[model samples]
Target: MNLTLHVNSEQETLDLAALLATLLEPKDVLLLEGNLGAGKTTFTKGIAKGLGIETVIKSPTYTLIREYTKGKLPLYHMDVYRLEDVGGDDLGFDEYIYGNGVSVIEWATFIQDELPDSYLTIKLEPTGEFFEGRNITFEPTGEHYEQLVEKFQKQASEEGLI
Candidate 1:
């Protein structure tokens, strides 16, 4: 299923991500797609906060992956943007994608084939009409993910976070 939301600011994007983070479970995989300034990392910071993590969340661009275990569930943040340049699957992606932690992958399309059969995807794009406006699209692949999306949307609507 698919759901879309218009985020008016960076905080709104983070709020949305936090709300979705609350509904996530161990082993959950979120594929994030967007441009350089599309707020992917900002959204991830919110997820880290919602998961009860206290450390600063940053892009794993150079490091490939960052692990935050202080939260209720471990969060494995990954950046596969460099995958094309360094062509290989030796990074052991499956360990984290199917591991006992929540995996949020940035630029996931680079390694889409390595992802699990079921996962959630978030696509963010800037809306040129308004300043700080972002068009966020969600695509859930399985019943579990679909239900998670439904719950997030419901909570977001009730809290006026959408």
Candidate 2:
């Protein structure tokens, strides 16, 4: 199944991401595609919040991967934007991507070929300057992802998150 959401505020976008945290399991990967200021990291901030992570959530653009254990489950947040000139493998991103946490990659389009088959794909595009509105697309690539679609859609409907 596929799902789409239009978030009108940065908070709504994060709420949606937190809803996803409830549905995600270990080893789940999310390949986030978007341009800069597209809410990829903002969406992830909600994931951390939803998962109960207490540490600050920031882009790993320079660090490659930021691990957070304060959440319900571990979250491996990665950013590959700076690596367009470098190689993903050189940074050993595969290890974190395939690890036991929920790996969320920002600017993941840069390394699409390396993405796993069971991952969920999220595309966020700017629709306005406020950063509150977005054109979002969700594509799940596995049975686990199907559950994710069901859960989030139901959550959205129940919470009016269209």
Best candidate (score: lDDT): 1
Candidate 2 structure, TM-score to reference: 0.90
TM-score of 1: 0.94
Q: Write the per-residue lDDT of candidate 2 for residues 17-118, one digit (tens) a residue.
A: 988888888888998888888988898999998889979899998887889987788999988887787656656667777777789988776777777878
Query: How do the residues 1-162 of candidate 1 rate in per-residue lDDT, one tens digit apiece?
Result: 799999888889888888888888999999999989888899899999889998999899999899999988999999999896664377799999888999999988788778888899999999875447999999999899999889988999999886
Candidate 2 ranges with C-alpha deviation above 4 Å: none
Worst 10 residues of 2 by lDDT: 85-94
Predict model 1's lDDT versus the native.
Answer: 0.89
| lDDT of every model, 2 decimals | 0.89, 0.84
Worst 10 residues of 1 by lDDT: 82-91
Q: What is the lDDT of residue 19 in candidate 1?
A: 85
- Runs in model 1 with CA error above 4 Å? 86-88, 129-131
Clashes of 1: 0
